[model samples]
Target: MTDFSGLQQLTSLIRNIEAQMEGAKLMILTHEHREEIARHMVEGLVGPSREHKVRIETSSGEYMNQLAILEIGGNKYTFSKDHQGMFISEINYYTCRITPNSHGILVYHQDYPGVIHDVSRVLAENKINISSMNVSREQKGKSALLVSLTDEEIPQSLLSRLQQLPQVQQVLSLQ
Candidate 1:
């Protein structure tokens, strides 16, 4: 992603902090080698001022991967960078894939055959077009997450249907 796109993506992740979060604490979790880039990301997200409601910190994490975890809105989200670019690596500790795509659906479900088809069918039935998709699984038949980029917002009824799926554990729509 371009710098602008990266900033836009970071803004989406931190929008809640700027809009409704009060007395927020943002933890930048990464390896020592990534402190510089992590700090730059923190500044981009919360700005340079110390008076904001967000408390920023850059702490050493366990690994050397180009990943950063943010604690905001009572949740922890992990974003990682790779050759493909920056995307959400996990949410609330669940392994998943999501980019700063700005609009998409995040589905946490059991790793099972046809889950992807089922999700696509639901969206297709509702006339929602999938622009892209990213799926990550911890193991076979175990916890998994699918992030689907769409052209439009997911309706509440469609979202409810997705939540009702037998393999689905959670459904989150991001815009």
Candidate 2:
């Protein structure tokens, strides 16, 4: 039998992380093999989460069997195992990792010229240094998610300013 223990643990962890960001509404999609077990495990795990009900579905793709997808806060986060037998994947297009010990900002916006310059200018003006940046987009000149790690915490004022930018749709500060 396939083990879902790690998958259960990760599901709980993701809920905890998202709960800190004003709570999360969760949805899970996976293979059909052990529906009752998977549902029971996930339901018990996510009991204390902001949204308790986990919508489980059978995914059709051949490569999607081992994957567990969580839709939280209107974003889809994919988690699965690597061939090495450890669960280590997240949907690449929407999931970006911000390192610990760094003040991180997640920006959802349209991909356009000067957006980076605008955001960088604001941070630079506030003496915030960018330690790292990870950006993912579906296509050029379209929507993108940018995860920026800074040397220092971003203040509310700067966050508000960034949200005011024309291209920026949402800004979230994460520690």
Candidate 3:
């Protein structure tokens, strides 16, 4: 009878420990899910983000990687990651530059010799550093140059000088 009583007491203690461990595991799983949710939220809102919802066509499972865009403007930016949510860790080592920032100032006209160099010279003469630069021309005479200047405040004189060039038709500061 004494041995049976000791076994019953030990069994009761073991049951209690098992119950507590189960509760702890539940708590841990809940915490992990919450952490994953929060990580995705921050990734969605930061930087110049454009979301493209897509899925992998594999037998494993369905998953989506949100394309996080870091636009340097004018088709150049660091590709952050393809994550299921906005989880901003530098874990994504992939990079890409697309759909560049043409918002600062766009100069358009017919393509001519010395136009690009002249534009640079004008900016250099005015002491404004070009933060970024892009040039595109199609078949025919159409041409466009996008420039991101260190100075947001572009002087009217510089704008006028660009317009005065024989081959140039339009000089517009986008943003």
Candidate 4:
């Protein structure tokens, strides 16, 4: 997976949904440790200021999949300045179930009121169990939610429904 195809595969995933997320916070990362390369790409995309939003370039497997663990977004500047390593770990959901390429994270933003509830309900309605969840918001009228789950690809209809929500800005699944 360390071949050039691996890099192109991830890049294509991101580029496919980048424009839908104007003003949405982004946390660009990799399963490969390429700080200089990641930084160059992010700077070109997210801009140089890096104010309210952030981009965290951390190390992970250069070849296979990675745990869904991720640092918060707004603190990237503090992280760059403080120099104190802030490591938060998340347990992979399907530790015993599926292989690496099968698990991934789900990201989306929906109407603040009952968004999380709606997501959980949707998953339950579809028999998708939520093993771990992390939801946060930047300010009034802005939010980000990430759910790392096991096997079973979320169906197109469900994903489209989430994307059609009134206040939902972006919906993307990365594996």
Candidates 3 and 4, the one with greater lDDT: 4
lDDT of 2 by residue, 1-175 (tens): 5555555555554544455423333333444445644553465346535455455555554665345555665555665554444242443456554322347587888999888888888899899999987778778988888878798888988999999998999887764
Q: Residue 21 error for model 4, in Å? A: 16
- lDDT per residue as tens, model 1, 1-175: 1342463366465563334555555555564435455555555565656345556666667544445666666767776766777766766676655666456678889999999999999999889999888788888999888888888878878888999987999887774
Q: What is the lDDT for 120 in model 4?
A: 68
Candidate 4 per-residue lDDT over residues 57-166, each given as its tens digit: 45443423331222232121111101221212221221212112333345556437777777667778888666656655455565554554545667767777767666
Give every collision pair in model 3: 43-86, 73-100, 73-101, 74-100, 74-101, 75-100
State the lDDT of candidate 3 residue by residue for 103-125, as single tens digits. Answer: 23456667777777888788888
Please, what is the whole-model Cα lDDT of each candidate in the order they appear? 0.69, 0.63, 0.39, 0.43
What is the RMSD, in Å, between candidate 2 and the native fold over all Cα? 5.9
Candidate 2 — which residues are off by over 4 angstroms? 1-68, 79-92, 100-102
Candidate 3 steric clashes:
6
Report the C-alpha displacement of residue 76, candidate 3, in angstroms. Answer: 19
Q: After superposition, how far is residue 37 of candidate 3 from its true place, in Å?
A: 20
* Runs with alpha carbons beyond 4 Å of true place in candidate 4: 1-105
Rank by lDDT (best first): 1, 2, 4, 3
Q: How far is candidate 3 from the true structure (C-alpha RMSD, Å)?
A: 22.2
lDDT of 3: 0.39
All candidates: TM-score: 0.67, 0.58, 0.40, 0.43
